[model samples]
Structure formats: C-alpha cells, structure tokens
Target: MTKKAQTPAVQNGNTDPNTLQLHKDPAQTDAAQIAAMALGSVAANAMTARTFAKGTFGTLDVTECVMTLKQRVDTTHDGNLKHAETTLTAQAAALDAIFNEMARRAALNMGEYLEATERYMRLALKAQGQCRATLETLAGIKNPPVIFAKQANIAHGPQQVNNDSFPSSTRIRAHARKRGTTPDELLEGPQHGSTNMDDRAATTPTRGHPAVETLEPIHWPRKPRRKSGGGA
Candidate 1:
C-alpha cells in the first residue's frame, strides 16, 4: 500500500508564517497594513529631509564663498580706481605748473622785446635828427652865392615886387640878356650849379668794395669731380 499523503498544517488557510491568511478578518488586516505603511512612509520622509538639509548646506557654502570673493573683488576695484584718480590729479597739477611757467616766460620775453623795440625807436629818432641838422648846415654853407643873388634881386626890385611875387623865367632871361650872358651861364655858379652832388654820389660806385664770398663746395672725401676745369 502507498503511504498516506501528509496534510499540511494551515493557519487561516495560509501555510507561510510570514504571510497573513487571505481568509483573515479584513478590518484587522487592513489596520495592520496601514500601520506598517505609515511607519515606512515616516522613515522615507526622514531620509529625504536629511538629504535636502545636506544639499541646502552645500549650496549655502558655495553662495557664501561667491559672496566673499565678490566683496574682495569690489574692494580691489575701488582701491585701484582711487589710486588712478589720485595719480590723475597729481598729473593735472604738474601740467598746470608747467603751463604757468611757460606763460610766465612768454610774458617776460614779450616785455623784453617791447623794451628793445622802444630803445631802437628812440635811437632811430636821434639819428634822424642829427642827419637833418647836418643836411641843413650843408645847404646853408653851399647856398651862400644864391642867397647873395636873391638879396640883390630883392633890393633892386623893392618897389616893383609884391610879397607873394615870384621871379618869372622871362624876367630872369631879360636880366641875363641885359648882362650880356645866357640864362643858364648866369645861373651856373661853382656852389649852386645844375650838377647835383647827391645825384653824382648816387651814380658813382664805391671804391675798395669787398668781394663777395662764394658758397663752399659740398663733396664726399676721395670723390672725383664731375667737371674738373669749371667753376661751380
């Protein structure tokens, strides 16, 4: 005969100890499942909260480092700008001083130039006066014979001449004809002749004049002349 089949021991129609029976009371099973699920959810939430806190702390550290670096950079930029401004101000002052000195020198030079011009003008006036006096003296001495003739004419014509009357060429010619001479021959005297000394002096060349110096020749050393026998 076959051995009799062993019957499995069952608790509420489930043989596994870990699994609840399907035939168990529904309300009690639901309550137990809900309690287990609530505990699992609470653990999951605690783990998620810890992870979020760690990520937030890391982000805060990064933000703090960025803010610190930005602050340092701002401080350095401000300091550089201040230094540049100071240097610019100093340069402006130095340029102003230089310009003022240039202006002062210009004014001094202008004053000296004006003083020299004034002195030159005074000397020129003095020389001009002396030249005029010398010309007047020469004229007086050289015109003595003409003065005597004019005086003789005035004395002879004292009754006929008015204050504004000038001797006409016809009257001068008649007087020269009565004297048995031509008008030109009577007028021509040694000192008061038609030959002007000023004109003669102007037309005559000066003696013992210095020769003009020629320009120096420009040539490189040891170079052959282009034209050997001609003046440059």
Candidate 2:
C-alpha cells in the first residue's frame, strides 16, 4: 500500500496573520493555581492552636506556630517559582519561533510581507502581555521583595496573598517567650537547609516579567512596489 505525504498547511493566496493563533500551555497555570490552594490550606490550618490543642491542651508553642509560617512560605514560594519560570520561559521560546517564521515569510512575496509584519506586531504585544502576567504570577509566590531581599527575613514583609487568617509576627513574638523562643528566630523567613521549598530567588518580592518582546520581531526585507503605467 502506498502512503501519501501530508500537504503543506499554507496554500497560496490565503495569507492571513490573524489566522495564526498562539497556543498557551495551561499545565503551568493549573499547577500554580493548585499549589496556591494547597498553600492556602496549609496556612489556614497552621494559624491556630486547634490542631495542636489536641496534643498540648491549648498550649501555644511559638516555634510550632512559626513552623507553620515556614511551611506556608516554602510551598507558596516554590510553587510560584515553578509556575513563573515555566510559563515565562515557554512564552519566550514561542515568541522567538514566531518571529523567526514571520521574518522568513516577510522576505518572500508582497502579500506575505504585509501579513508577516502584522503578525510580528501582534506577537510583540502578546509578549508584553505575557511579561506582565509573569510579573503578577511571581508576586503571587510571596512578597515580591522576598525573591531578592536581604538574608534573614530582611525583606519579609508582613503582607501575604492568602495568609490573612494567620497570626501576625507581632502576636507570634508576644507569645514566643512562653515557648522559649524569639519572634526574630521564628519570623525571620524560612530556615536555610530546612524545607524543600527554600528557593532564594522565589522568596524575594519582584514584578512579573515576560519572556518575549520586540527583540523577537524580525525586520522585514522591504520589497519594491510596481508603479501604475498608462497603456500607449
């Protein structure tokens, strides 16, 4: 039996930049959202003595409470980092490929030049949007500063995305003396070599960044347009 070769997707005279669509990977986004939910759950459970009350009879342990924060930061920070890196890196690669393809097309016939240039513009805009999204996702990891903040929780801000239900560092410290620990030791960010969630870059607060941009746009080789002439 003879097998036929697949036909090329593009046919002549059907050049349309808008027809090309960007394929986004939902896996990264899905992972990030699920991680967020899990992180949130962990934080909510760690905020109180309810879980510990069963064993300690309502005794508040500062180290124990701080451990909860550590766990929360670790999970959230790590997940956010994974999502950010995967998402941004993928977007950058996609944009780069698109630009190259568009550039190749622009160097061909007249119609293709226009179509490819338009697509190139659209790609730039898409890249910018992705960059902003990347920034937002990274911020969701924890405090944006934590990604690059000074060591020892120097950049550990009091704010959190889903940690409203958790106790404040001040309260945790106030109750620490009762448990033979200091607040600084507890709230000073995740302990090094402690949890798998310790990513120095992910813990820092930072704006979301895009993986692609105008750099991906290819310069079109201008083609000459024929002038109208009257028949003699």
Candidate 3:
C-alpha cells in the first residue's frame, strides 16, 4: 500500500519543520533531524560569538580611553607639584641671600663702630697724657718758696729778715727762735713747718732784710672741653 505525505504544524501562516510528524521507523529519519538541529545550533552559536566579540571590544576601548585620560591627569598634577616645589625653592634661596647680605652689612657696620671707638679712646688717652704733663710742668714752675716768702713779707714788712734761702730744718729753727720756743718742741707738735725748699727759702730771706721778693703760684691750664658728644 502507498502512504500519503505528512503535513507540518502551522503558525502565523508558516509551517514549522521542527514540529513536523515523524514515521514510526524513527531510525530512518534520525540523520535528517540531527542535521537540521546542528544547523540551528550553529546559528545560535554564531549570534552569541558576535555579541561577545562586540562587548569585549567595546570594554577594551573604554578601558584604554579611561587609562589615557588618567595618565594625562596624573602627568599634569605631577607637573604642577614640581613647579610649586621649584618656586618655593627659589623663594627660599632669595630669602636666604637677603638674610646673608643683611648679616654681612651688620658685620661691616659693627667693625666700623669698633674702629671708631678705638680711635676715640686713643685720642682721649693722648689728651689726658698732655694734660697731666702740663700740670706737672706748671707745678714745677710755681716755686713754693716764692709763694711763702711773698705771703710772709706781706704780713710782716720791714721787720722780717732777707737771709740766703735756707733749708726746711734751718727755717724751722728760725721760726722756733722767733716764737721763743725750742726747735725740738716746735718739731714735735702737729703744727709742722713746710718741708718744701722754695717755702723755706721764701720765709727765711724775709726774717731780717729789706729786699721785696715777689712770688707767684704756678697756674696749670685746664683741659679744653670737646663740643661734640662722645669722642667720636
């Protein structure tokens, strides 16, 4: 007997071969069904492969772009930091130079001040020496005898003698005689006579002479006062 052709299921006006009925002898139709199933699986595998490839490529591109931007930003930030460091270093150096210069100037000024002070001290010492010398010279000139004799003559005019200048011991003897006292008694007391030779000469000559002797005390000049403040 001859068999009729089998029809497949229909959906949306199309027949689906996958849903077609098979004969009772399934082994004879197994090869054809397996081939169709393999073709459908290949189509699905290709679609999956395309999707994975597109996603992987897009992810890789985005990652590369982000890395590049990060690298640029990091480089820019590093450059800014380096510039700031350089500027700070320069400013520090400038400040150091300024301080060093100030110290140097201060040292120079100190040196000058010390030198001026030393010069002033030297001048003052020189002036003091000159003053002392002048005073000593004046003291030597002012004969103490002349002053004593002049004072004595003024007090006791014609009655005083004008003997040769005597030593202090002789003058004390004469003074003791005039006072009607012993030389030893006069010498022993606190009222001692002048020991200076000039004083002895002046007083002794006036005891019994008519000679008018003039005596002047030596006058030492005073040191001149400086008008400027401090010697320098």
Candidate 4:
C-alpha cells in the first residue's frame, strides 16, 4: 500500500510560509492602501510647509509644519484684518516719506535749476500718485468694494407675439381719432401754401422784385468778321 501523501505545515490556511499571502478581505487591503496614501499625503504636506517656512527665523517640527499648512487667512477674523491694516499703514507711511523728500528736492531746485526742478517735480508727482493709490488700496482693504450685478430674468413660458402687418398703423389711427381727424389727413402732415423754399420764393414777392416776372435769355454782342484775303 502506498503511504498517504503528507501535506506541508499549513498556517492560517496557507500551504507555505514563503508564498505571497492573498488578502481574503477587500476592505482590509483597501484600508492598508488608504493608510499608505494618507501617510504619503502627510509627508508631502509637511515638505511643502517646510519650504514655505524656510526663510522664517523660527524652527518648526512636523506637527508645527502641519499646523502652519492648515492655517489660512480668515477674512472674517478681526486679527487678520487688523494685521492687514497695520501693514497698509506702514506702506502708506513709507510712501509719504518718499513723497515728502521728492517734494522738498523739487522746491529747493525751483528757481536755480529748471531741469532739475522739473525732474524732481515729476518724481514727486509720481510719488504722490503712488501714495494716493496706496491710501486707496488701504481704504479698499478696510471696506471692500461691493459690486452690484443686475440679474436679468428670462421668460420660459409661452410668449405673446404681435403679428400685425403694419405695426404703426393702429397707433396712427388712434392718434388721429384723438385729434378728431382722419388717419390719411394726419399722415399728410401740416398744410402749407408752398411746399418748399423754391415754390415760396417763386410765389411770394421779394423786397424790391415783383412776383410772376419772366426772365429773358442774355444776348452777347457778336464780333465783326473780315473777308479772307492775301495780305499785301
């Protein structure tokens, strides 16, 4: 009798320890993949945070880096608004100083050096414009601009269309009726004795000229012609 084939030692329903283990539960495998992805994401975010914080003086660990990455400017926060206001104030002050210096140079060179005065005044004007722009920016930051966009309503239902052959005819008739006149007469417009200036000039007499005068053709005098002959 052949001896019964002996099976290798099985652990957790696996035939061999060296063989790759097949995950029976899809959920477990997915969970492991998700965990790895999460770890990689955290590392990436931490690296980005490190790069962002590189020039800063303070030292930050992974936790601090993650926290910093999570932080964002809160528009509704008072502290953020105050910080922005302070920064704008500082910039405005710096611009004001530049403007004052340029103005002083311009005034100093006014009578003595025309070119220098012009150049300095031009620079001062530029600085003044920048300061004004900065102040305007600060004001905008304090109270943000509100834009009003007019919303147009579209009609989706059945629309009433006017299919009148002559759109103005009805209005003309109604207006003529209100004036107690026929539409044809109203359309003929105001009655005039003469239609145009030429007719009026022909029909009416001028200050010195009589009306209905006939103009005759002008006759120029003919020059006398000599008989052709050989000259002696």
Winner on TM-score between 1 and 4 is 4
CA deviation > 4 Å runs, candidate 3: 1-79, 111-232
The residue-by-residue lDDT of candidate 2 on 1-232, one tens digit each, is 8754233233433233112122245666856755654466543465454344534443333334445556656866766466445666677667556656655554553465676667666665666566566656655554554456543433467754324466777667758878766755533334454443434434655769856656677899999998779775
**When superposed on Cα atoms, how far off is each prediction in RMSD?**
48.1, 38.5, 47.9, 18.2
lDDT string for model 4 (104-139, tens) is 998999899989999988888888888888889889
How large an RMSD does model 3 have?
47.9
lDDT for position 156 in model 2: 61
lDDT-wise, the better of 2 and 3 is 2
Best by lDDT: 4
Predict model 2's lDDT versus the native: 0.53
lDDT of each residue in 1-232, candidate 3, tens digit only: 8753234222233243223232345665787765663465433453344345554442122223333444545665675344434444555555455545544544555656876555555554554455455445444444323443343444445464455674566677778889978655423333555555234345534556677988898899998986987676
Model 4 misplaced stretches (Cα beyond 4 Å): 1-79, 154-232
| TM-scores for the candidates | 0.16, 0.22, 0.16, 0.35
Q: Answer with 2 or 4, whichever has the higher TM-score.
A: 4
**Ranking of models by TM-score:** 4, 2, 1, 3
Off by over 4 Å in 2: 1-80, 109-116, 119-121, 128-232
